[model samples]
Target: MHRRRSVVLTALTALVAIYSLVPLFWLVVNATKTQQGLLSSFGLWFGDGKFALLDNIRQTLTYDDGVFVRWLGNTLLYVVAGAGGATLLATLGGYGLAKFDFPGKRAVFAVVIGAVAVPGTALAVPTFLMFSRMGLTNTPWSVIIPSLVSPFGLYLMWTFAAQAVPDEMLEAARIDGAGEFRTFFRVSAPLLGPGIVTVLLFTVVATWNNYFLPLIMLKDPRWYPLTIGLNSWNDQAQTVGGQAVFNLVITGSLLTILPLLAAFLLLQRYWQSGLAAGSVKE
Candidate 1:
């Protein structure tokens, strides 16, 4: 009976993997075709004698006076600033909530929990209004400032810190004449590596793929991230007098995913270790 259950679970896992990968496979296949070929060809396979993968990539990078490059740069900036800031805030705040006992700690935890329950989409309009009133709308600050706050990251770090960081270790650090900040940096922070990496990966992916926030905040094409920029190409393909760069759009999508894929592949070991360590009490 156990053997049969294992087989069933393995089969289900394989199905889920295929379901996720099939669309990525199709995207890669279609990215190699011309706009006409993409419209005419089977989505899952290459078109006959129509391997224009290199040309599509060239055009995607060089199109519209290299606006794609600018978009890519903008995306990198946002990801680095937003994700990095979010991770720092989450780590510090979570550690504090886990280790320190201050007045209003329960109130703060309640607020954080409430924030986690609230969907970001629900806050978008209000955030827009607030930023606009502050004259931050249409600026990169409009995206970066808001992206710095990650409720889920805080929650994850809070839980992980509670388990990973022990009161005995902190007390020892204090005994060694280490200040609170020094103790955190020297003792608690190192032990929190797995949790920090986990939160960093989450925030990086979130900032990289963020679209709607940037879309509503940014008016100038110069400030657009890769998500909004690629989408604009798709929108252009449907409009009269706009360049029908469908091939570029598909190729660009493939290019956009490559960094994220690379990041995951490179960090998979750390992420898995962190998640595993955080899950169990030592």
Candidate 2:
């Protein structure tokens, strides 16, 4: 009976996995087809195997004065500056909150938790207003500065640090004449390895996928990220017939997902380990 139940569960999981991946599979298959083939071919199956992927990619990059490349560069910049800065800030903030004690510590922690509960979308209007007042509304900084404050990432890091980093290890490092910062960098940082990767991946993915803040803050297409760029393609698809932008949109979506996929694949092991560490500890 137990074995039968296990088999049933496995089958259900497989079914769910396939259901989730079917659209992705279709996107990949369709991305390799031409505009005509995309419209005519069976979406789930390979279309004509004539290898239009290179052509599609070339056209995608060349479209609208090479706007796609600009968007890609902007996305990379946002991810590196926003998410990378967020992760570093989260690490320091989380480490401090987790390891140190001072006046109003509980109040500070409560504020961190409150910040996490607030959705980023809810802050977009206020952020835009503030940036607008500063004359930064149309610049990349308008999007990036807001992205750097990842309250969720900070909370995750705090939780991970509290559990993963041993006080004894910190004490030992201190006894050997390491400063608090040195101890954190040399000892706690290494032990928080899995957590750091988890936070970095989460922060990077979040910033990379962010649309609303950029939508409100940026007025320039030249500084738009992939998310906004795709939205532009979608808008053009609504009116432009000869543009063949529907195919471009679909293909561009497939291309846009690759970096996220690569990031997850590269850091999946760390995420798994982080989860295990988090779960097993509690």
Candidate 3:
């Protein structure tokens, strides 16, 4: 009876896995087709034979003066700069909050906790107004600056630092004549590797998928990121008479996801190691 129950559970889990992946499977199948092929092809598989995937890619690049590549570059810039800054701020701020006792420390921590409860969307209008007053609207800095202030990332780092870095080690380094900055860089920072990677990944994905901020800040299509660029294609699809861009949009979407997938695969091992290290403390 126990073995029979295990078999049933395994079959159910397999079914759920297939159900979740079916859309991705369909997307891969359709992205290879031409616009005509996509219109006629089965939603779940290829058409009569095959369509020109290379031709589709060529058109996607050549269309709109190769704006897609520009958008991709913009996204890279945003992700790297914003996420990098946010991670640095989170590491230093989290370390400070966790290890030090300063004037109004409790009040400062209370503000951080309150910030974590606030949503990014809620701050958009206020940020826009502030930038408008300073004439910073329609600029990349408008988005990148806000991306650096991630309360949730700070909270995660604080929790992780409190657990991962020990005060005893820091004190020992001080005894050895290392300055506070040197001790943080040469000693405590290395120990917080897993936490840093975790926060970096979170900040990267958040900045990459950001839409509303860019939508309000960027008025020029040349400055648009993939999210905004794809949204333009989707809007065109809605208003235009044909599905000429159906394949291009699908293919563009697929390409946009590759970097994120690469990031996760590259950092997953670090994330796992960090979690395990945090769990098994000496």
Q: Per-candidate TM vs. native?
A: 0.95, 0.92, 0.91
What is the Cα-based lDDT of residue 105 in candidate 3? 87
Q: What would the per-residue lDDT of candidate 1 be over residues 1-282, giving only the tens digit for each residue?
A: 999999999999999999999999999999888877877885799998668999999999999999999999999999999999999999999999999899999998999999999988889899999999999999999999999999999999999999888999999989989999999999999889988988999999999999889989999999999999999999998888554688888899999999999988988888678678667865
Candidate 2 local lDDT, residue 127: 86
What would the TM-score be for candidate 2 when compared with the true structure? 0.92
Where is model 3 more than 4 Å wrong at Cα? 1-20, 276-282
lDDT by candidate, in order shown:
0.92, 0.88, 0.88
Candidate 1 lDDT score at position 158: 97
Expressed as tens digits, the lDDT of each residue in 148-230 for candidate 2 is 89888889888889988989888999899999888887889877888788889989989999989999887788889999999
> For candidate 3, lDDT tens digit of each residue in 141-256?
99899999989889888988897888999999999999989999999888899889989999999999999999999998988989999899988876758467777888888788
Give lDDT for model 2: 0.88
What are the RMSD figures for all models against the true structure?
1.9, 2.5, 2.5
lDDT for model 1, on a 0 to 1 scale? 0.92
Query: In candidate 2, where is summed lDDT lowest over 10 consecutive residues?
Result: 273-282
